[model samples]
Target: MSNGRKNSMQRVSDSPRLLRLGAGASPARDKQWFCNPGSGAWPPPTIPGRIMMMNPDQNSDPLFDFADADDYQRLRDLLAAAGFLDESVLEAIGINDLPDLASDHPLLLDRTAGGSALHTLIRLFLMEMPVEADTFAQAIRPMAADSWLQAGLVRRHGSQVTAALKLLPFRNLILAFDLPALLQTPQRSRYVMGIGGSTITLSQLTIRRHCRQTLDLGCGCGVHAFLAAPHSSRVAAVDLNPRAVRLAAFNARLNNISNVDCLEGDFFGPVAERQFDLIISNPPFVISPESRFIYRDAGLEADSVCRRIARQAPAFLTEGGFCQILCNWAEKDGGDWGQQLAQWFGGSNCDVWVMRSESLSPAAYGSKWIRHTEFSDGETGFSQRFHQWLDYYERLGIASFGAGLITMRRRSNGTNWFCADESPERMIGPCGEDVARGFALRDFLETVQEDAALLACRLRFSPDLRLEQQFTPSAQGWQVSGSTIQLARGLAFQGNSDTFMANLMIHCDGKRTLQELLPDMAAALKADPARLAPLVCQLIRKLVEQGFLLPAGQENES
Candidate 1:
């Protein structure tokens, strides 16, 4: 951490720019909190399985109630019947209100047909449009409209019924998140988030094997924890925002996910002295000078969240466990980024793989986030906030910010490796399996260091691996540019290749070991066996690591 970050941390203790966050402040008054439907005036009610700030109150709570399993099942059936539960249906209807897109797209024009209970629910929840009182009542048959009003999920205006939360479909699950436009309101800081690109990316990359326990740190809407529930015996999800935890708890129940335990507190504060087989987070990792929102900004200076989490994660991980997180790191003035990241895992007993997806310049990065928060250029203090963000980066001597995924595995003994590489822009399909295979290959390389040892191992080309040759018609008549070889699935690695290497790949059919193929390969290349041996060994290692080739037994795994 830099001196600037240290100073910033001290400044954040009483940051005038920031409002009081969940510190006895009323939800309606506090900009850092969203209205929790379940709480009352002063200290909130102590709900079961929740850590609440206690103060015995004369008035009973008037707002939100958690949904029961029966309500959830009815809700699920209703949504599924109406086709609102499928991602394709939502996409076709242009229901994904991502930032900067026109919300009033034509597809949503006729959404409120009121043809059935599902359409009414979709119009009410998905479209964020108010439905008629009688229709809304009939749509939610078992659960009355009065129940929704009491739960703070809806409000009544004349004969209209309006929803407070946005119930969006996410990968075979429905998540009730704080409204996206809520951030633009006066109370704009701590709205629980809906499914976005980052959330989807983190879930896709998570290793999904059955595990003893999983921990989702900074689990805003508990998407990761909910997804991990069926795969793990138990899931403990923690967040800094109380409102977020409440909503997450609601989502878990709405989806009838019984295994997740939602807790409220700062990072690692709620789940102390606990170990997990898999630990995952898409934390507030924005490299900003100010902490406007708990979901996006960590407030611990530039990239400190990433550094702190990586360092602390090892102690909480079981042997051979995996801790995966999506993070951003500032590129320091004098140091290399790879080395800077490697230092994050310095004292940990974990093998780290930092797969960089993109690097953004200060201006571009600042503008993107500003738009995300819905702060326009014409807004008051917009210039000050934007300049402060840029000045913060410049003061730290940061050239750029690297955004990527960091996957770490605890290795009890042996030498730990820190590998940093750029990954493909678009990863295809479920890549958790590819990530696991890559780790196995890395471990194999570590053990089989010698050329002889590598040659003894039988290798087969990955089923999805492909080799393509490109040529262009020039003055020399169709000269070849180069041969490219890559995995067609998962991480989608593409690289240059040659005729000999291509042929070598074909010969690696799992039946023959590299040592056996060496004599024939040398003869085909008109070279000595000693020279071909080293080249073949090196190529095999590279291919295996990239998932273009797999060791014999491993080919059957994925």
Candidate 2:
């Protein structure tokens, strides 16, 4: 580790206000709903409103063994038949979040319209509401609601049964994960995050290449692992949190996914001697100064967990294997950000690419995470956490922090490459193939080192490539002010170009090699072919590297 990294880590560990927990605090203090700390748990320092809580009671576990094929399929059938599994159904009901759904919504207003099972199930499970035991039983009939009680899914209070867990509906799959504080429940520490925008983004960006083994490091509820299972012969989903492991297993069962093996251990710990062809992690990448939630914060100073994962992943990847991560890293006060990240891959023999989506200053970044974790706690508490977060960042000398996706491929040959660039403003569709193609292109470029070699190969512009022209509307007729080229499909990239280059790019229809096209292009431009050849070749390399143009036979491979 560098001195800068050591200083940052020291700053996090030296926080007098939050470095250690109260001595007398016990896991037994909280009820059965608390998460078990087991051996790896690091309880957060006792802030007035932020004390960590955990309950080891086995009865608190959700009853749905969503892992059982027959039961899970039956449950899926019931959810589908009841119309509770659709994404649009929640939107139609105006149920964006738990607090948004009004008490007077039709689902709540008339719980049993034709004795609707969907309505009953949604109210009881998704909404975390109480229902009469008989009504609940009637609603989930043929599946038996008593089975839920025995599974610790619901608890009976007098004649009413209250839900203990939430089975959220995600794209053709049901995920049973933890929920946050509601009107009745206290602020939760054991909250297991479910399907959200971050998870979806990571999933969409994940490459889908077939592999013998895949690993989902820090697999929270196993979403990434679940996505990898079908394409991989075996997948190891590892997490430090036992609760997360259990919940992930439950989710796998819920979806009838059979190939994932959920293991409870920290990053790379459980799979010490094992290697994989693909590895994915939506780890606790938040660079928090203080630990609050286990799902989001690694409790390390700066982004140490992300740094360690990136640096160490190569050791656990097979030759030509790829490791992808969604992470955040600090932009230190006196360090070059790119080089700081480049150092993580030092001596790893891996090709690295980063697509940064956003960057935030210390103040803005602290405020965003503070608000996310403390929003339900009320404004006064939120204000305090936000200030403390900013103070911590200042002490650590983090000027700004960047969030991005990183992909690394372990290459057997000694030569390696590192690319750090901005991603598209908005991702359009599944660009996993685009990522794979980019890596393949990088490998090909490594082989075709000479300019003459590249010129001899045939190339063509991508079908999704589009040319756009911009002009200033003045007294002079539409004078060409500027022009740009864009990609409409995967990894959308837009770059400004001159008319010659734009036309030059459009004209390459894969019919001729670059050496053949240069003479005709130069003749059409009324420029010397000798002078244009080098410039056109240089531009072609840039365009091809950015995915604006593809080599002739490489188009179908994408």
Candidate 3:
């Protein structure tokens, strides 16, 4: 990283606070007033009386209590009618991004000032700002505002009312969870996290094929379980945090989804011996020094939680089932990260694919996660915590941390393969189909390991494939100097190739075997096919692995 970027990161890491609240909200007051229900610290020593207590039993808790199912349905409909779904809320706020804990709230509030009911909802729930009672009441008309207040969705103080919980409209469903500010406090260890980048990334990476059963292991607020509900006959959402379980159950009811069973237990203990066709988890895999938060820390040693999940997941997966996990793993100095990760899945009876996204040094990793939870602590406190984390890493002999998605498929009979590669920086859209295709392609490659077998099988270029050439000004006018072959969508893998390779890619039309195409390829290169066969086979295998080419008649398999 450049010095400028490093300085920027340092500033973010050392910042005193994350949330910048609007009027009537103070960080000190929030810290003093807010407390987890079952932490034996409820009713803070100095209570401002502005915030109400959240019941330990979520069923009795106002936030989870839905006296009337229609009321929740009406709430969902009201928000949807006002165009408060998915990314539309971002567009309505005149911003292309969702507001986070570090977002400038006052500026966002000013942008949405004096706007429609949608804007009111945005300011109240999304921005976590206090709204005028009259404005809030008007925004939620037809459905009595008292219902919202009674349900503990919002708390009133004099004429102003603030949302007690966050209502996130994501993927056409309204998910309820604790406010983002709660995440910054140690007291709120049981905080149920709302939608985050990891949640969305795991959802996109998950295979969407219809399944007999789906398990959302470590399911927070049931986002993955809900996403898997439509295609799955039954979905089981398990979490160690009771608060998360309650919120997930409440969300399922709020969305009128009856197929998801939300349970609270550690890891796979809740559904022991029960097999699932698909298992997805965005587990608490952060390799932190302390287990302060349930949603982020696993209370285990360095990366042990992730390793445990990988080792145990295959036992719960039915034959040919997939287990996809988003996690962080520790990397030792001068050690191979891939080989270490492969050891986690050794003798697990599964084919593992590790798509590493990024690796960061100990300092960088410590700064990033510390900035996330301890941002509320001032610079001095942040510095202390940073050094403490560094000490922990040093004691553990850790050099860096690797963050990415690990996908494993339960293979009963065939020789299982372990494939590891750097993932593409960006995905065009949902790449679940691409993930399935990748496994199938890997399997195909395994079957045709020999040169003769690979050449005997006909292959075709991916329909989304595109080849581009760049010309340099040479004595010979416009001679092609370089070229690249790329997939236009789905994983969007792209790499440089020469003229011979470009021509070879275009010729894979599923009409001719590699043996047949070799003659034309060799003629273009003015070389004998006998001598060029091995080189051609090597290039074709690479193309197939990168998804630029597919075996004939297997491109469209689910």
Candidate 4:
């Protein structure tokens, strides 16, 4: 490890002592010391100091309380009956996309002005706007308004009732979480974030194979855990923020998900002895100078939190298990960022694949992150944070910040391989199966390193593969000037190709081995089979890696 990384680890190690001081102490005292009022210390104190004592009767909290499982089920059924699902709400709101921030609520409310039950529900829950008591009562007919108020779903104010939390209908599951506006307050440090870009990316990147046990490290509002519930026999969701843990547990109950257990602790400390078949984390990975938010910032310096997770996650994973994390890491000046990442997995016994989506210069990175939370802060505050972050990056010699998904699969028996590359520009939908297939393909490629072995394997083009040809008008009746091949969905990887490669792909129907196809290919090109064989093998390897082509038996895997 580098000296910077060592220092970061030491800082993290020293945090526990501060936390030990608050052991067996009252929650009020803990909160008072950890969150010093008017101190203006961004995250108030150290990372460990943010750990709050979880209430024994967390479920009974007015904001989180639901009468019972049946009440939860009733609320779900009522929403469904009122057309309050993701698709229905989107259609009713005259928007194709769901509202991500509180700023989008005005448009949603305007579009959902119709006085129907669905519109009323949308205004009440989705828009987080207060509705008249009679309108709210009429909207939830079967269930009385008092029931809703008693369950803490809504709070009455004069003649109107407002939802206490934001209820999002996501992927057929309803997740209740802290409102977006909460992030602007002093309590923002512990505010639980709802669905966002990182959450969606990690969900799509995760390998969805059914497992005996799964872990959602730094799970906020239990979204990942709920997504993993049906596929996993049991899931454990852990976070350091007590409020996040409480809300995640509340979300599980609201969604009627019994297999998930939400716990409050830092990193893997809560589940030290437990092993999981799958582990997914979208931890506090912003590489910032200040730790202002538990959901976005880890108090450790640089990208130490992500590095620590990469180094320690393997021990908690079972053989053949997988751990996927969405994170940001520093790119040092004149250094290979990929190599730096590879070192994090040294002796981890895991095959690692890093799909870096984007990298931004230190100035750009600092500005973007500072603006995310400090947008409400006037110009002076924003400028101060931006300069402070830039100075921190300069002092640490950071050139840029790279953000993306890191997927690791444990393999105890063989030599682990590390693959790092830029990810596809866009993903159409869930690509969990593609992730699993990528791992399998890498394993196959490692075994068939020899040309002879590769030639013996049969291959087929992916069903979603597409070929595009570009032509110029000046070139005699639309003659092809360039051609490219791409996938229609999933990772959506694309690459430049030629007529010959396209024809070769047409022949890859899993009916003929590469050795058998080489003769035909060479004959079409009027070339020697020996020369064409090497070129074809290389192309095939590239196609398989990009997921445009799959080995025979793997066609049906995804």
- Which segments of candidate 3 are over 4 A away from where they belong? 1-63, 99-107, 184-186
Alpha carbon lDDT at 202, candidate 3 = 73
Worst 10 residues of 4 by lDDT: 13-22
RMSD of each candidate?
Answer: 7.7, 9.2, 9.0, 9.0
Q: What clash count goes with each model?
A: 3, 5, 0, 0
Q: Which candidate order results from sorting by TM-score in descending order?
A: 3, 4, 1, 2
Q: What TM-score should be assigned to candidate 4? A: 0.85
Q: Write the per-residue lDDT of candidate 1 for residues 2-62, one digit (tens) a residue.
A: 0011111111111111111222213232121122345543222323432222221223332
TM-scores for all predictions = 0.84, 0.82, 0.87, 0.85
- Candidate 3 residue pairs that clash: none
lDDT of 2 by residue, 285-347 (tens): 778776666665667788887888898899999998999988789998787677778989989
Rank by lDDT (best first)? 3, 4, 1, 2
lDDT by residue (tens digit), candidate 4, 408-523: 99998979999987777667688888888888888889988888999999999999899888887773577777888888888878777787898989899999999999998999
Off by over 4 Å in 2: 1-70, 87-115, 182-187, 376-380, 469-482, 523-526
Error of 3 at 344 (Å): 1.1
Residue 110 displacement in candidate 2 (angstroms): 8.7
Q: Which stretches in model 1 have alpha-carbon errors above 4 Å?
A: 1-63, 66-70, 91-104, 111-114, 377-382, 471-481
Residue-level error in angstroms, candidate 3, position 366: 0.7
What does the lDDT come to for candidate 1? 0.71
